[model samples]
Target: MNRELPVFIRSLPLVLAGWVFAPLIPAHATELPLLFSDGAVLQRDQPLPVWGWAKPGSQITVTFDGGTAKTHASSSGEWRVELPVHAAGGPYELSVAERGGETLRVRDVLVGDVWLASGQSNMEFPVAKAQNARAEIARAGDAGIRHFKVPRSWSDKPEPRLAGGYWRAASPGNAGDFSAVGYFFARELRTRDSRVPIGIVDSTWGGSAIEAWMSAGMLGADATVAAEKIRAKGAAAAQAATQTRARIAAWNTAPPSPEAWAAAALEESGWAGISVPAQWETQGYAGMDGVAWYRKSFELSAPETKGELTLGLGQIDDSDRVWVNGQPVGGMDASWNVPRVYRVPAAALRVGRNTIAVQVTDLGAGGGMAGSAEQLYLRAAGGPLRSLAGEWKFRTADVRLSSTQDDINQVDTALYNAMIRPLQPYALRGTIWYQGEANAYPGAAFRYRDLFASMIRGWRADWSAPQLPFLWVQLAGFHSGGDTAGESPWAVLRESQSAALALPATAQALAIDIGESNDIHPRNKQEVGRRLALAARAVAYGESLVHSGPVFRAATFDDTKARITFDLQHSALAVRGGGRAVHGFELSGADGHFHPAQALIDGGAVVVSSEAVVQPQALRYAWNDDPKQADLINRDGLPASPFRAERTRATLPQQTKQETR
Candidate 1:
């Protein structure tokens, strides 16, 4: 063999030597993974991976900014090459090419620190949907900043790659859909180091649980879906169970007219056209139950539809059945939280036009495609990828399926399998999470302690960053003033979130002050973002600034009053309101009846006394669902987290405690 022979020519000797090999690379060769496209930001000061599918065993090379990395494609067609650390700067081009194959050039790739912003509805709350989005949207242009939203995709099993997605640059047009917390965080990071290009990977799901974000290995067999469902508080579980049983019974008794409904030739003139990636509630069909059908049409050229294909519809709420070109392809009976990735055999696809029909049945919560708009797509089985988001026709019957809605939020590791797993192995500077409302279900708060800590541990292990700086937002204030503070589940949940601080290099972005009583998704996400940014400075960037409010470190009590000490450094304790009396304190006697206490600040400590609490044995601060006046601060403008003293007997929710009894 000639020394300068091409990869294919050099491999001829191995083939003649009777070496077993995978199928040869197609004419269309190499490609970057879903997260490695245009405007993607590589983590700075870390090895940058440029990975994708290449010809099996083919030589692949990635070149960027005066550096190059090379590797051979594995038998499975997977190939990866790591470039040396590239500092924070780029409008540079990333070129990935395969020997004797195709080339991919990702334009506007930047070398910068990357952070994963995640959690439930609050984190997913977009800038456009934020309180002051219009003003923010008007000024939302920063080419240096980019966002890669891992379109919501939940799975039962871990996926090697995202079906299809891309990195979107921040702009007036795109920022509206970007996570307000994430966008605001990135924007503030610009203030600290404007020169460092920043990228935010917004991977969040509205109304999702902390468990849904953990991997299967972390959750184990018979996952949280089975375990937590047993501990599910409130009447929703029983109602859903009843409705599900009846729905299944009715379906088994008489299947609906699905054939006619899935027919491609059916006229849908009366059907309403709606966006694919939006929830039905937001799409004007709130509180909808029973069944609905959605259809979208896309084109495929002569050569394009010949090969095997895959359809990525992100994730749907409740249940869904999919059809391609009037032929049934696949479906999930109860996969409310899992992403839909259906494989379409070549025979099912036509050469020119294609129709994708999805029939969804929602028993509860939000409906329709509850996943990301970015993840919906049609891609060649092992080749080029395409986007299948945008418009689709939807129709629903007036009949309600049942009195209960599906508990999709409890799906086991569904979000982790689809969204988090694929992004793994991508370097991360750290993660910022905003969640916990979902875990406030009665007795669920106690369970949150172990699960929350486990999630942080597993995520760190997954990212290969043992000491990764993980920052989270404590549950914000909500509901009426916790007059029944002892029994509020929200209070307990916040305590569990604080318990995770036991882990190192972790901080909580105190949100007890920024929360709204009437709204779970508060409009003051700017403060939330700013507080998180402050934590990044101290915990992640090692800055010498105060990033947290006063945290309850220890409590000492005299026969009459209690003094609470906090972990503080250069910062001093202040009453936050012109030295006014501090609120959100409670004192309990041996009888365990907690009474509102009068609190005042005294040199890094909060002194509290309650006239009603004689011989105070316990103390609590901000111990309520919504402490309207929990205004303790550390002069840093950051608010203190809600806390309950050990001496105080924490009350469980009335209904929950009674039920447990």
Candidate 2:
């Protein structure tokens, strides 16, 4: 009816012709870079997606083996074409053609199983620094094992593709760069089955909060997430404004007189005496906050050689600004979790006795210098320097500040947008996670289990693989377990992790015994990997091997005695500490006050009884912040998972449903 309709409609044919004939333009005109290229395995029975970008409205065609498919680029310049499902075989070639007569060819594409390995720093930890890394490196020459590292990024909006990365085969030269957990998991998978090509995509960021990895829309959908996001944003903004104002005020203030500072450095001053490498709270400075200054003087050699100077100041809490001879050498902010190593230029060093000063700022919890009691040395260029960590002067300063809005926004979704979105669409066999350490605090981890499940479901939904295997390591025993029977956040989080197995095709690895009481990052990663491998064998490889230790099944009580049965695979119940009586059993009556109960392993069940809990209504095992006495192991040498049980009709499903509701 419109006058221009006929002319517009008439031009449609020409537009179609242009779109059809656009392939003669140039090579790479319609090609987009493939992500998760390393060790990528196509699902055997699924229509595999081979997607990328090209010129808008470009005619794109793909050819692989003896099959071909075609699709046109959309207005967004993105195009995707699905390859027919193939069997578990590879070493094939793929070619993509687009407008401008350009063709992009990829070689050595395989069909098999792929996996997405993700988590925190523990998962991001590279194999180069892992135990026996050299030995592992020697055996890295496996063409069957492939790896694709997702480049780090974050966005508040959900994205379809990631920024950068490609696939590479595992070799001694490249294995060092692979994620240790992913490499180990893939190694085990390959060892068990050599016919399939295994691809592992590493997409973990170090020291990232779980919220950062979640989609912005998902976070917005939940009221709790929304509230938490608001609170966190407000806190971050307030902190940032405070820090900015303080920095400006400090800059405006008169600079410290060099002579006065030098004289003060010489005098003992009123700096409180505190041991180096000791937490401030432990050193009688409890509840005391702000920046604390510490000083130490060391006599240097007469002739200071001009060379590289190494300054090792162990570690500082939150942030630190270090000075040597009144000159700022180096500083670190919000990096207290790791030791600081500073390479000071020789110009900062002096010949005679020099003063080394450090100002540490504590934001929360334990503050002050930390780490091994190794000597802090100052090395000269190509020469040895003096040890400076032994005995040094100390001082304290009070300064209150906070972070800025930009800082908060900078950290938001930075991990997810950069690390996760790019690895999407890559077919994977399963997933393995090792986190929850960052979310162990009280009240913070309550929703973590749901958040974790949501993340898993989100990934599965995104990948279109509903039945993909999902396995994770339960929180291990840590800290010192107190005698009192009370609610523990770590235990709750572990229970949450265990409950996540309720999702389809999921498994958990119990590592209660493999953890170190003194260290949160346990050194025995091999056991963790092997245990994860066991879970993979059962869930992913369809093996009938005993993959788990003992999981609590049911508990019944009669008068004063409670009979607790378990689902132990491959072995009978056994106490790990060589005692006839089992440990970590606590029975509680209607008062809800739990008391340590005597326990004994009979067959595959444990009988718990206590005079204090004659009418036992509930029982808990290994339920503490740091469970040191937990020795409930099975005959297979695997530790039992921590759990809390009640005699009431509340079952696992009901509990989960109630929690969700």
Candidate 3:
């Protein structure tokens, strides 16, 4: 591979990723930020920035594409030079040198459309971890797509740059660790225009809150939402969680010892048989909660056990602790969507049959491992790969709800100061967000409408693009997509997400149909990426396209029914899979209790009315955590955005409404 020309980049596998190793600045020397690295793709047709740190009062000079720029370092050692806007074509080098400062060289940088993809786990979900990743990875060689993964850090004050990270090109070796949503987004865009390069910066953290990504200045600017800063999570949850931790800790060391359930030679005659990689509930442990133990025995010859092995345990719901041959190898807590890849030392394995014991703690939903059998396997270092997903013995250890890990990232500006501010003025074409689950439960969702909007404004202001195209994913149907005919916080959060679309150059992608009933983080991220691409095409690229599905606009009521009109690109509203009727419509009269209603598509509107509601006052569509049958889609195959049309407040229930000062 030529060092001067950008080539396809394939990183080490997922089990060996997330550790960033890149260039850093030295004292009294001019150095580039982590964002400026080999294979970096700068936003074209926009004023580009060449910024970095140097000695105070130093004269800094930046040269790029035969253009020259100069600036003086401030008292705080910060300096920057703006590169005049240029066309979208580059395989160029940028050099920075100071009269009395260190010199730096950034190579193989491309000029193109740059998008910042941020949010929680689903957005951070990688292409290799997504569904059909194997096929995608096998053919995932695209030089036009570049990615810069921002390392995670939090601070009280704005940092000049990230600690360590680098720009990597999209290739099979490294593409799996790249954001699935981001990869698909760029892939779709590049397919439309191969000449234009697409650069996606993934600055995401799993389980992060919206408040964590909003600057304090922006949070303070919004008087309505700024007050929510004081609403930090309760200490009781933390205290109780600590106490529970102490108990669990003591129980683990209480002996009989750890071998009572872990020993390779231990008897398993009394344990029930269950398959690995499937939820226990489906295998006769239905609706059961608490800690459960799963043990499996596999034969490994002496040679096979001589070298270290990589254990691919997909994802364990909630938390898990694993042991091999009575030796504690590894475990994780709370962060469920992260695939478990443990490096098993050769010392932990021996000739003949070995026992693998896993204690899965189910805090919510159900216990056991949650993944397909195909994803559970073992690959010996430089050796053959074997499956570990056959019959296993399972026994319930406890049946109590585990303590919840209180969120510290919810601290007002902690995340924003550390994650967003440092990348300020990075010149982004737009942003894509996937969040709100944290703010969706326990009385915080009602305030998300304002907070979410403030976050967008704050990020845009930081980027210096007021009308930046912002696209977000509506919370997918959850809780099994079952009918929950009661007030739901997730539904409110989705509504809050929809509320942000009122902002200029913003769009929402409806995904009520693609969610997993048992899993909050859906693996079908290809659709998510494609939907966001549609939004980018319409809002960012200025294309006349049907990028969105039907959206509920207003409701016109009558004596016996409510003719609910909708807003869409066209008046062609139909079910997603060739069905005539759509579900998830609820109607309410003066009584205010919503009931499932018969929904009929009349032109661009979905006429909804319940037999019980003779005089309808309100109508709602797809207003539940998991609306499994909410299949109303437009001609472009986009699902309708969830909405609620409430004209009167007198009949509205008090439990569903929270008044924030």
* Index of the highest-TM-score prediction: 3
Instruction: TM-score each candidate.
Output: 0.70, 0.70, 0.73
Where in model 3 is the C-alpha error above 4 Å? 1-25, 221-261, 264-406, 480-484, 647-661
lDDT tens readout by residue for model 3, 1-661: 0000111122211111111223444577777777888899999889998788888989998999999999999998889889999788889999999895457888888999999998876787778668898999888899889998876555545556675568898998899889888999899999889888999988876667887787778677553343344233324334444443333332322225556777777878867678777876556543344566888887787788888988878678767888889888889865455568888899999888888888876654445787677678988767767888878887765543222222434667655655677677788889989888777774677778889988888787777789999999998877733234556778878878888888999998877889887667777888988888999999999998888888767777777777766677754788877756778888887787898898877777677777888888877777778878688888877888777776553122233444232
Ranking by TM-score: 3, 2, 1
lDDT of 1 by residue, 253-332 (tens): 21257877677677778677788787775555533455678888877776766788889988787568888888899887
Q: Write the per-residue lDDT of candidate 2 for residues 299-338, one digit (tens) a residue.
A: 5564553665677877677678877777777888645546
Question: Would you list the C-alpha lDDT of every candidate in the order shown?
Answer: 0.74, 0.68, 0.74
Q: What lDDT does candidate 1 reach at residue 168?
A: 86
Worst 10 residues of 2 by lDDT: 11-20
Please give the TM-score that candidate 1 achieves against the real structure.
0.70
